[model samples]
Target: MVKPNRPQFTDVEGLAAMVGHGDAFGVGGHHFARLPVALLRAITRSGVKDLHYVSWAGGLPLELLLEVDAVAEIDLCFSSLDIFGLPPKFRAAAESGAIPVRDWTALAMIQALRAAQQNLSSMPFQLPQGSDMLARMPNAIAGPDPLAGTDTGFIPPLRLDTFVVHAQRADASGNVQIIGPRALDFAMAGAARKVLVTVEEIVPVGALRQDGRQSILTRNQVSAIALAPGGAYPASCLPFYVTDYQALSEAFAAKDTVLSDKLRLPSGGLSERLQEAAKVSAETVLAMPAPAQGDKKASVDEIIAARIAAELDNESFASAGAVSPLANVAYRLAKATHAPDMIIATMSCGHLDIAPSPMVLSLIESLDCETAAAHAGGDDTYSTYYQAGAVTHEIVGAAQVDRRGRVNTIALRKPSGGLLRLPGQGGMADVANMHRDYLLYIPRHSVQSLVDGVEIASSARGLLTPAERDPMGYRTGKALVFTDLCVFRLDQTSRELIVIETMPGVTHQQIRDATGFAVTFDAGCRELPMPSGDVLAALRNRVDPLGLRRLEFVSAKERGALIAEILAADRAMLERLIAAQKSPAAS
Candidate 1:
């Protein structure tokens, strides 16, 4: 019943053969969703080396390649394990200079790919002037735009040799259907010389035409198609399975063993091993100790969230990106309380008109997908909103903050020539350049973080005064910082962050001691307003009933304890099963 002349229908091996050594590859998926894992496994089995990867946010597949020494270079906006924390293998490789890295912001990456798709030589963008990211980027040139007649940065086109993507379904004729928010997949595919798609299912021809909106690719654009159910294992495929958080936790806990023994398995055995590992992980999570009840005390994360929520104004459009659970909580709490009409846009949830259910550990899974007023068309939506100055507020965090409120979320080059590469700038650069107001949320305030100056300015208004900002297309947004101990506001005249208010228990000396540089206090500096009974009630009872905020403070020892308990339970279960089988009277 299958038609042979319908397009090239192939298997993983065939897909791998299409990829050659030293080819520049573009991968689809953001964080943990819809990754082309099966094809990546095949490529690993084929022992391809010296690959160059272009990804929006490099996740597990990219980390695996780094571990195997197969990747020569990486072009990415950000790279991490999401909620599970850092990707150890990738971090080690990047820090050791094992692989070359070219970092880009999420917006810049999309713009560059878009330029390639349109056959343009380059794309102009507005970013924070004097940012170290601009200086490091080889292709990014800084100058006044001839067309716009303003200061701007231009990124050259990035065209890949091959692009691999995963979809929910596809017809035999190679028409691909993608559900949920399509990240940079469409543009990446269009900009690539060849496109390969692995889908969960392959339907009959004309099956996808029923919903034309979901069909993002046609036969002309697709080079080949393969059926790869659960191809994005470990990562969520949406409407199919959520991310395997427990498995990732276990993997991170035992990174050496997992990466060496399990992830290095041959293609024929990798999927099976991953499935077995996932089963164990599921059991471990089900056996985790229940959180203590009857404790109504607010956690450090909750306090930070509540304070940030109070800063939101009604009827304003606010956005939060990845690794910002506290910011997302604050946005939801604001909607539930003071800002009932606030429009919140999260990178995972898109545009949410209504308040999402109580916070969960994972933003991608718990946020309301059905009720999202609109999907954030990935980086396109972000860039469009920013350029149009539609985003009023943005909540972001960074690895380091200088006296001038500048942020650095990139590498920390040591005097000994060692490197400590943090997750890249993501969309913070775009947010700094466009939004009317933005807040920096620092969970841990210390001398190291509140430094005199950053080695590299990733996002900030360095020397750009209000006059300069206007000419450069930068907004005159109030730059405020919220930390665990105090609140700091940037002085309009000095551009230096000065203490505006201290927390309930914090002292002036504490603030001074925590900051690396000499501290300055405003004349009106006083204690921050404590969270009212009403705000606490809404946050605990409605906004975060599950008490998931505790995860942010969960220590490594606690995680080890949980893992030990899981192993004990597994052993006991196995022993009981063996005893029952032995006692059943051998036949």
Candidate 2:
């Protein structure tokens, strides 16, 4: 019987030490586990074999743990070799009859944790418990209410043993304080065994009470307090400081290194003051004003110039009759995989041309969006619907990803001390939840995109900072993150993102230049294809084209190329774009 007052370890190792040798902790089985890698490492170091991970872990850790002959059973939600990597342990876990696969949600897990925290046998949940996942899950029963079957037929009554949390600040008595987004930490705290709290700064008791706002985590609910400065490092959100995308990108890029190289970052090295300062720096940069450099007159001139250049390029192309490299790539992939209905995108500010070609859009438009949307069900609200349900495949993009198949799409800092903060909860979180085979798409190298740490608060679910996700159940989806030059897939067995393929023209040096993280090559890697003409045509014609005139930062060559491509699809469309470019209303 699990109870809320039980003594749990605040140290990661202690948390791991609590699980039975063969006991399996059921993480959110549909997505990635929210625990930080360091904390997870302690659990793995505990040498338990029976692990019930969510769908999003990607199997990298499972594979590594298997190598030591420690793991014996496993469970999965959906299988995507890219996010989860290639690992034999996945098969072993499946064969062991220990696999308890099911469809679950962050809400259900939170309810379970809440129940554990409340020291109750079970807590009432109101989510769609009638879904297939809870059909036969132990302890989950149909509600007695007559209206229960009207929407979802059932309710989940989850049971858990422990809930671990890390916070920005805490007193020695375990008064935790958080500085970022809160999904359901309070509910999780209410559902787990003696909650373990880790804080960046352990303040005196009086400090918390002095400010009425310090009720982030009360001391009474916490069992032990651990002073682990920088403990959150790459996994926790330190308000004001964005994540270290550079460091994380390097780890993702350098796939040949030991998995631990990607997981272990020294957390105890940084002083409390420095950590706090770094956090502030991140916030300061994010708070900075967006540039107001766009001038209407200049924008019109640039657009006209670009349009003229494109005409020349098109004439040249007419003679050469050259095929677009990107178009050809898209065609082959569509042909080889059969026609997929939708395409997934990220940070997509209403523009498909950022990376997708016209031909790709055409192919997508040909499919049935209505049908695709229906099949996608609750997960279809994202812009990228291709990867949602059974629509063939879709493309996904991520900012920072670790070997554990974890992705960071939230706050990350730039080298110049700037931050790219989302004004709202962008579609990344929704995309992660809906997409089935997420194809990560990004440039080969990111100057400040990948980092050793993440600063921004998570806008969506998957593996949120320790403070945000407590009690170990919620998870997010991460399939393959494709960059300009290479593709990183999760090893199915270990659930680690490993280099599985490289782009046709990508070189190691070029990849390094294009990426913000380290990259490795797969000896047996295959070449990824680009967009086809049909797809490109659709992308060009169907998607609205916007011209950024007087955007001084715009590259002339890129502008010319884009203009030429846009004109080739339809001269009339180009005229509209030019008109828009000339309009002051564009401002």
Candidate 3:
């Protein structure tokens, strides 16, 4: 049933030789985790041209492929560098209008892949109302549903020619094993004609069968296997390493050049070293002494986190998407303090119903799975949580939000003429209508961000009244917006954002001056309650030990130095996790 004799035993260079011009290519991993870097390096070096790259959640891999003028077209759900900021090459390319890009929503992307794997011509999906995502998404057929006479959209199958992934271990028989959080890789493999895999370890067929991790791509599905230990470096490969943020930041700084030699480490004696180091890091985290409480000045990050935590109930389903460290902190802070039973999903990886872990960088990759009650990919997550309306709250950041609650995450038309591109609308288009409480946050809110009208409505649910939503089966809840200045709640009847309370230092007059629209607040208005001792302690000492939330508040110029400091501390812990034989179970 497999294709006729795609090379079964080859190195990365040999595999790279197989990728032809204009082939639809897929790269594995979610965000900065578990990507096939060695293979990407090989592809970049090989000088293949005019390839159509498909990355459902594109990150470093997408950027790397764009280095040598290889990718002619990119079909992606989003392109970002997560906490580091925008993907430089991807952003520059989009801003310059050099290469063509097709921005797809998360759910639509998966549905397209599903159609491909299932051998269907096209897949029909429910079009989200109250947004213009469909207008921006090219190649999608949107109109009245001929069958039901309701709104609908259809996308052609994402037929991929080749796909590559990195995994913990694989056998000569081509059994690929992923230790944890196999995000979108399975769907990619299923949809592609040729599946190439690189692994951290190549084990005997018998050992591969007996390994505790799940074997996702069977021998029949895999076309080739390459042995490359620590192949997923710079990106975390679970028990092997956490994201090499220092290396990644350095690579980003280097501009368009490929820094493979400096980034990839020799795998010999690496496992033993990382295993021992991991044990030490685990002990350090577990044995960390509590900091003494005092009049330590509270940061804006802590204030926002505490305020968001206060919104949580004892038992609610909350989700923190990729690149949202503030939401990550708030959800964990809420669980560690008041809402003991809060169920949280860590990232787009779908680490569903995870136990609250410390807000460490490694926690998103290592401890997330160790502590998670269950794990699934993007498809299962949407089906079970997002589409079912089980996710009560999801806190997302916006590039531009309007008085009517519409968001612009796609791009902003510049006064000078061209587009000022943002990270493409990831899942916001679809998930905007999914969560029970459609919560949005803007870390640095000003007249520019809180606009009268957004340039592109990538996602919105501004009208959330029971009357408007009950008939559509959408969740009826408040559309709350949080910012550095104050909190604004959307008035469904009026369909406009209204001030609820100002921050402690910010006055109503300051808010009015900063806002682009009309407001109904003055100097004598209620301010958000100051975070108490317990809340501050939890934020400072207990939850966010690495200060990940501060990444959101800092300016682009300031982020490098701040990231270096945080990543250095994170590296020490990850080095230890990588050394341990059996990672200490997440608690």
Clashes of each: 0, 97, 10
Residue pairs with backbone atoms closer than 3 Å in model 1 (clashes)? none
* Candidate 3 per-residue lDDT over residues 1-587, each given as its tens digit: 24533338788898888888898999987787778988888888898999899978667887777767889988888888888798878888888889988888888888888888888888887676678877666567787778778767898888799998988887756777887777787778879988888888877767866756363667777888888777787777777766666667787777555665546665552444433332344334544443444568787878888999988987688988877899989998999889988898976736877766666675455667667777778877877788777888889888889998899888988878888888877888887877778889998988988999987898988337887666556678768889999989887768888888788889778888888788755244578899998788878777887789999888889998998888887766555444342444432
- Across 1-587, the per-residue lDDT of candidate 2 in tens digits comes to 33333233356566556655554343211111112345545666666665444222334445445545555433322222221122344544443434443433333444454455555666554322112334423455545555534322233434334445556677554567754323244554554444555556777766766543223656666666556555444443344222332343344345566554465655555333323323222122222232232322322222222212222211111100011122223322332233343232221211121122222211121111111212121122221332222222233334555544344443345566554321111223333333333344443236554432344322222432333223222223335655545667655454445676556666667656655445556678765444444433332232222221111123434534454443343334323333333452432
The candidate maximizing TM-score is 3
Candidate achieving higher lDDT, 1 or 3: 3
| RMSD to the hidden true structure, all candidates | 7.0, 19.3, 3.1
Any idea what lDDT model 1 has?
A: 0.70
- Candidate 2: regions farther than 4 A off: 1-16, 22-35, 54-100, 112-144, 147-152, 210-215, 266-587
TM-score of each: 0.86, 0.42, 0.93
RMSD of 1: 7.0
Name the runs in model 1 displaced over 4 angstroms: 1-7, 209-215, 256-295, 348-354, 362-367, 413-417, 462-475, 550-587
Better of 1 and 3 by TM-score: 3
lDDT of each: 0.70, 0.38, 0.78
